[model samples]
Target: MQFMILLDMTIVNVALPHIQESLGFTEAGLTWVVNGYVLMSGGLLLLGGRSADIFGRRKLLMIGVGLFAVSSVLAGAATSTGMMVAGRIGQGIAEAIAAPASLGLIALLFTDPGERTKALGAWGGITALAGTLGYVISGLLTDMASWRWIFYINIPIALLVLVLIPRMVTESKMVREKGAGLDVAGAITSTTGLFAIVYGLLQAVDHPWGSAAVVLPLGLGVALILAMLIIERRAKDPLIPLRFFANRTRSVINTASLFYMAAFISYTFMLTLFMQQVLEYSPLRTGLSWLPLGLGIGVGIGLGTAFIPKVGVKAVAAVGFAGAGVGLFLTSMIGVETTYLGGILPGMIVFGVFAGASMPAGTNAALHGVTEQDSGLASGVQTTALQVGSALGLAVLVTLALRDAMGEIQQGVDVDVAMTAGYGLALRVGAVLMVVGAVLIAALLERVDTKLRDPVAEMVQHTA
Candidate 1:
């Protein structure tokens, strides 16, 4: 269930052009198909994590999965653009509920250190694999069937999972202090603040930076976020514990993850468009083309998991970031005549390897030394970084692509030339962002392996 939800995010990218043509969407309008889901998912993640802590994790997972299934049906049957966007938003909400709860449940379920490490390794591996393979699956669905089928496919799988969840997964909930209830004020403030910021960023692609559509929402978002912070500080039971940021390693890793994902997200979204729209590859061929990249990521992640306990998280993450930068730089050099085997494939392989290796090490570092009390928040923070980064990345990249496409068209460039120029510029910018992320990680992360024998004990001692 976790893998499927995560995969769906990237899978839809391959069919973006098809969706645009069928729905009669403008470039900016089409972007919301992706951004709508991302914004809601990212914004609600912290709340979802807290909800699982207060309610029951298993129950929330079941509800989230069921909601996702229903939303997928709605998205597949969407006849109008608005309907599709609404369905996408619904899907995001479902994902937001499912993700953090799933992770928290895993932590609660696995008590032994060795068993937990193995379990986490499996989880990381599956996530990396799903991300890589989503392109292939999406491409095949788009080419062989209608783009709607990409969403339709999720329905049966979700149903199967729903049936199995109750039987297989044990029910568990956090032991909160007496009389604790959901933080309604915190939920509203945080969700609205995140939505405003993400919405503003998405609009910046089509609207001028100074336009009211862009500025007002962004300003409101910033203000709401400030209010949320003040509320959190004073609240008896805060949704997001601000103290989690006090740990230098955890704080730095979260920041770095956000920046890194921004680049990675843009690259995947734009690259899928380039292959299908600009390069004009068949869906089957496109799917097959991604195999090497997918396999590479699986291999890279396995190796990183094995090495982390030896060389340490900081060193592994640093190397992974550097490798990712090199891969992104290579991707930026691609041209209209670039061959898949020689040009695109090599870069994909390199990227897959670096990304695969980096995730485990980074996650380990971020969650290291966290106590039981802080585990859910730590999970929420990490996942939030990823989703928010992707949302921000896509918004920025789409905006840049639109600006370049418009400029080229105004300059009387041919349609093909204009489209290629926009995509090319977007890829180049993505590469630069990856390089910047690498620098941030290298400078900010301290070389420390805080995955001690008893993380809770360490945290308690540190507090004392």
Candidate 2:
């Protein structure tokens, strides 16, 4: 269920253009279709984590799965822009509920060192695989049927998970004060603040910075964020525990993950459009082209899990980032005449391997040395970094694309040249971002004892 949700988020990217055409979305509106879900999902993650802690993780999982299923159906049936946006918002809410709870359940389920490592490796592998394959799946679905099917496909899978969840998953509640309460004020302020910030960023590409659509929301968002900080400091049960940042490795890893994801998400977004618009590839062909990359990620994860402990998490993570940086550099060289095998495949394979190896190592590093009590919050924070990074990356890349395209038009370049120029600019920027991430990983991630087996094993055993 966790893998599927994560996969769906990426898979929809390949279908974006088709969705835009079919739904008659203006450029800004189309971007929102994707950004809306990410914004809400990222914004509410901390709250969702707290909810899982207060309620039972299993209970939240079941509710989240059901909500996601219903939202998928609604998205598939959407006929207008409003309907689609509404459905995406629902999907975001559902994801916010499900993601952290699912990770918490994983932490609970595996109580042995070896078993936990294997489980986490599997989880990381699946996440990387799903993210890469989302493009392929979205392309295939969009080509084979309508873009609607990209969403509709989630329905049955969600249903199956919903059924299996109740039977297989046991309920566990957070060990907290009996009278602990949800931070209502914190939730409202944070969610609205994030939404406003993201909305402003997205609008900035099309509208001037001083424009009402851009400035007003951006200003309001800053104020709201300030309000949230004040509220969290005073709240009895804060939605986000600021103290978690005290762990140097955890804080740095999360920051690195955000930057890494920004590069990754932007690459996926720009690459999809490049394949269709510049390379003139069919959706199915584009999807099929990614098979090698997806498989490579799976292979890399397997290898990393086997060898990383022997070397070190920091070493493995550094290597992975280096490989990803190289891949991004290669991708930046893509042009209109570039062939899939010659131009894109090599980079894809490199990226796949890096993503596969890095995600598990990064995730393990981020959560390492944290107490069991803070595990749920740690998981939520990691997930929030990913979603927020993705949204922010896309926003930044899109802005660059728009800027480059406009400049080319002003220079009287042909439409094709202008569009390709925009895409190339985004790719170059993504590559730079990846390099930055690599440097951070190399500098900040220390040599942790990876052979501790499962860091959470002792805690889980005691609880059980």
Tell me how many clashing residue pairs each candidate has: 1, 1
TM-score for every candidate vs. truth? 0.93, 0.93
Write the residue-wise lDDT of candidate 1 on 1-464 in tens digits: 77888678777877888899999888777778887887788778888888876787888888889999999999999999999999999998998788877887777677765566666778888886776677788888888778898898898889898899889899877667898776667767877887788788768876789999999999999999899999989888887878878888888888888878877877777777677777898766776777777787788788888887788777778788778777877886666777888779888889879877887878777777776655566777788888888887777777787788888888898766676678778777776666666676678777754443355577799999
Ten residues in sequence with the least summed lDDT for candidate 2: 447-456
Global fold similarity of model 2 (TM-score)? 0.93
CA RMSD (A), model 1: 2.5
Best TM-score among the predictions, by candidate number: 2
1-464 per-residue lDDT for model 2 (tens digits): 87778777877777878888888997667777877788788888888877887888889888888898899888889899889988998999898888888987776677555676688899977876776677678877888788898888888889889889888989987777878988878878988998888788778877887899999988999999999999988888998878878777777778878878888877777787788777788888777776777787888788778767687777777788778878877877776778888989888888878867887777777666655565566778888888888877878787778777877888898866787778777877777766777788778777653232343677699899
Which lDDT value does model 2 have at 229? 92
How much lDDT does candidate 1 score?
0.79
